[model samples]
Target: MNILKFQHEEDFAATGANLIASLLQSNPRAVLGLATGSSPIGVYAKLVEMHRKGMVSFARASSFNLDEYVGLPADHPQSYRSFMNEHLFSHIDIDPARTYIPSGNAADLDAECRAYDKLLEEQGPADLQILGIGSNGHIGFNEPDASLSSGTHVVDLLEETLEANARFFDRLEDVPRQAVTMGIGGILKAKQIVLLVRGEEKAEAVKQALQGPITTQCPASLLQSHPNVVVLLDEGAAKWLK
Candidate 1:
């Protein structure tokens, strides 16, 4: 794992956007793995700015998002699908057909998970994957103690995850208790992985991820074994690392 510390979130976002732009420049049809949450919001903003300046074009690029709430509609205010569309997709020229977000309303939830896994196999081992560390060190809703699913599947949200995410919803109860997420196998298969963390709240999680034992307890710690992982942290988030 390669760790890059930035003084501010804006700089962190800039570095991430430049890295993505570089990948897109090298391969127009690159498959991108995306994440949602406040940590990545700045990165998406930077990408949109790059798009407007012709610094990068996602016109031919394909993307797969990491997770979504299991029962929420795509248009739900708190849904990851809605988050991505509002934050990044709407600002870029990427073909909607080339973008894939797991369906939250599958009639058979298990079948939906199976289909997402298949879709990932067909389009992935993502060229680049963007990730955010949960306050509890969970990644893609793979809560602590999870053995780590090998494919897309439904998972119950841990209380920490629910609380962290509740800020996005009007009421805490509005936050869904279950979600569908691409599993660790999918995340580890990315050719390049960029994990972003910011703010003081993430300091302990970042420290634990960087220095803690490689147990399921700190799921993000698994990135230590990836061949091409880049961890970007703002000062506040990196404060506890030393």
Candidate 2:
């Protein structure tokens, strides 16, 4: 893993955006695996700025998001689909047809998960995948566990994840307890990965992910095994790292 420490979140985001832009320039049809949450909001903002300046073009790029709450409709204000549209897609010139976010409201969830995995298998291995670490060190919704799933599937959100995500909902209870996310194997399949962390709240998670044992108890720790993974962190998030 390559680690880059930034003085501020904006710097981290810009650096990460430049990396993505470079990939898109080299491969216009690059498959981008995206993540949503406060950690990546700045990165998306920078990408939108690049698009406006014509520094990058996502017209031919294909995208797939990391996860979504199982009960939220795509258009729901708190849904990851809506979050992606408002933060990234709406500001760019990317073709809507080339973007994909897993359906959170699928009636047949098992089939939906399988189909999503198949779709990724067909377009992947992803040229780049953006990720965020949960407070408990999860990547996507792959919460701490003895074993992690290996494809897109349902997950019961951990209490730590719910507490961290509650800022987006009206009440703590409004935070969905479950979600659908790409598994460890799916993320490991990506050709390159960028894990973004910001804020002091993420300091401990970042520290453990970088220096602790590779264990399912801290899902993000699994990235230690990936051949190409970049960890971008702001000073606040890197404070605990020795």
Candidate 3:
């Protein structure tokens, strides 16, 4: 758990992007575990800029996103697929066939989860995985619970999680009540993990995830047990860290 604090957003973005760029530079075919949400927008933007400058290449690289809203079409404006296309995939040289986001609209959802986990087990175990902590300390959609899943699965969205994501939709009710997310065990399979957090709104979560007891109640706290995790924080997010 290597923690870094930054006063400027640009510095925070660069640091996160640097970690990804460096990974791709060294391993052209690197498997990237990506995430969505405001925390990663700047990092994705920086990666796109670096791609344009010829500083990095995703041509041989592949990526897997953490989750997607259940019941949303892949082309939906608010879908994670659409979000990734607009922010990162569209600007990079990566092969579209090589990128993956768990299918949220599959008719057989449990099967979809199993197949997605199978894919990761057979081909992934990504070299670098990026994450964003929920204000409640949840990672992906693995909300606080007595136990956690070990594979990709569907999760019921909590009220706070739904409210936090409601800003992306026209109405709170428009936000999906469920999501397809990689479980904690799946995420922990990555060779490296990068947790990016910003805003004072997340300060308490940051403190709990990094310092509080490792419990299922706070999924991000489990990262403390992983061998390689780099946490990048802006002042606001680190305000409560001791």
TM-score of candidate 1 to 2 decimals:
0.98
Q: Roughly what TM-score does model 2 have, to 2 decimal places?
A: 0.98
Clashing residue pairs for model 1: none
Q: Clashing residue pairs in candidate 2, if any?
A: none
lDDT of 3 by residue, 54-73 (tens): 99999999999999999999
Off by over 4 Å in 2: none
> Can you give the TM-score per candidate against the true fold?
0.98, 0.98, 0.99
Better of 1 and 2 by lDDT: 2
Q: Could you arrange the candidates by TM-score from highest to lowest?
A: 3, 2, 1
What RMSD value applies to candidate 2? 0.9
Q: Candidate 3: minimum summed lDDT over ten consecutive residues — where?
A: 115-124
| Number of the candidate with higher TM-score, 2 or 3 | 3
Per model, state how many residue pairs clash: 0, 0, 0
Which candidate wins on TM-score? 3
lDDT tens digits, residue span 16-67, model 1: 9999999999999999999999989999999999999989999999999999
| lDDT by candidate, in order shown | 0.90, 0.91, 0.96
